[model samples]
Target: MGEIDTERQKLNCFRMRELGATVVPVKSGSRTLKDAVNEALRDWVTNIRTTHYIIGSAVGPHPFPDIVRDLQSVIGNEARAQMLNQTSGEFGHPTFTNGPGRLPDLVVACVGGGSNAIGMFNAFLEDKEVRIIGVEAGGEHGPWLPDGSDTDKHSATLTKGTVGVLHGSRTYLLQSPDGQIKETHSISAGLDYPGVGPQHASLKACGRVEYVFATDQQALDAMRTVSRKEGIVPALEPSHALHQTMEFAKSLPKDKIVLVNLCGRGDKDMLHVAKARGVVIDTDVKLNKTDFAQQ
Candidate 1:
């Protein structure tokens, strides 16, 4: 049903296994999100007759990003409607909570092939007063230069990559002149991708939106900060947005409203987070041998 490699994702694969789902493991590259995506596509080709491949990101073949964007637009629609609703409350308007916009002055989401970010931004695109931001994985460094003079260990595609075709879509991708996709890294498996959705590329190019990055450490720290302040544990991906949100919000008055999409739960990331912190989590919960067998 899915391809996973990180010990954290492996644990979830095991859980899905208990439900009798066929989960595959991708063992190449960084053994992270990118490898898993490749394995899943291979599996789809092998069982074309009986399988329907639904990818998680807003990337891949044309119409795929558009399709997923439509499906996920509910996130944006609801956020917009809710903001309007809040404005009708006791304060008589959101001005006391945010800036002059009927919608949020700023909306932020982490971009991994950009599904979540696009989903949260679609409804606000026409609202020029509402600014949207997409945050990319900063990997080892947020904005690493690729001139051979700086270390290359980040997935800040919009912030650092060049245009290239990838997964049937022309978008910003980390690639060489030979058109080979380069390896991407991110502590968040979800954001470990070299190519981003084409629409995200368009949005950035036309200046309809802004793109930024949060380093692995920055995301992790945001995860910890949100957990402590809001009692909510967020996945590493969207923690990038939170990191940016906290940074910007702190400089503004209490009246300003900044929305950060807390996209996923942190439950799937505990093992990885612990490992990153040099904490060894010794869990040997075994499952059937065939649970991880390729389909």
Candidate 2:
């Protein structure tokens, strides 16, 4: 099950259809990642004998987080090897000076459910000299409504959340005073989750990794910057990390290297990015309202 009205859902719907997979768009609750996870859990529970559930991020209970992280660690392993294998001055980036067998001065990645960041950081965890950072979504500033309610305008779980149990895991969560989970906001659908992985919570507790945040505007600006300077349109998820990377890189010396996990492609984000930039994308294909009606 996927959230309705998300670029991820829209893109995945087409891909899943092509791959002969049925698409179920969850329209209930907040109609977001949390609701979709709820629906998926419900479905899995009902079909326990026949269905196997696979979580998308490094979250969920017990072995699931460990399984996801171990699988995703290939990203860090490959990146580390690639960087070490490159000869001196082979990496075109001016920041990379002492090329072969040299470890990066810093490593960074965005943290939503924390899979990608954990995967990227795992290889460098033992390297005491390497600095690691995880960037979260600093959506909008939440203000109290006249009705005495609060609007949850951020998804910076590690940076702002309190200890809570979510999805069968003890982790940091965006919650109310009474311990109710709060709805979160982010321009990136992937980073809009209210709870982070338990591993991240543990890391934060031990101070192994430093968690920070990048505002929606910062991510949008970074996306634009990458497009203009690097000729690559980065997905909003990675754009958060890129924003932090840019700021951190500015403070480092020319010889210090920073590696950012630019994970997702920006194909699905073109329309969203254009809309955010106040530019309308004219498309011959139109989506009918009935197409998204609750099943």
- Give the number of the best model, judged by TM-score: 2
How far residue 61's Cα lies from its native spot in candidate 1, in Å, is 0.4
Determine which window of 10 residues in candidate 2 has minimal summed lDDT. Answer: 87-96
* lDDT (C-alpha, whole model) for all candidates: 0.82, 0.84
Question: Would you give me the overall lDDT of model 1?
Answer: 0.82
Model 2 clash pairs are none
Scored by lDDT, model 2 comes in at 0.84
**lDDT (Cα, tens digit) per residue for candidate 2, span 1-295:** 5364455446656777899987777888767888888788788899999999899798888899999899889788777766776433422343433445688999999999999999999988999999999999988642233475655788989987999998889999999979999988888888989999999999999999999988889999999899899999899999999999999999999989898999887777777777788888786686688876853
In angstroms, give how far residue 13 of model 2 lies from its true place: 2.6
Segments in model 1 whose C-alpha atoms lie over 4 Å from true places = 1-4, 86-101, 145-148, 285-295
**Cα deviation of 153 in candidate 2 (Å)?**
0.5
Model 2 stretches astray by more than 4 angstroms: 5-9, 86-99, 142-151, 286-295
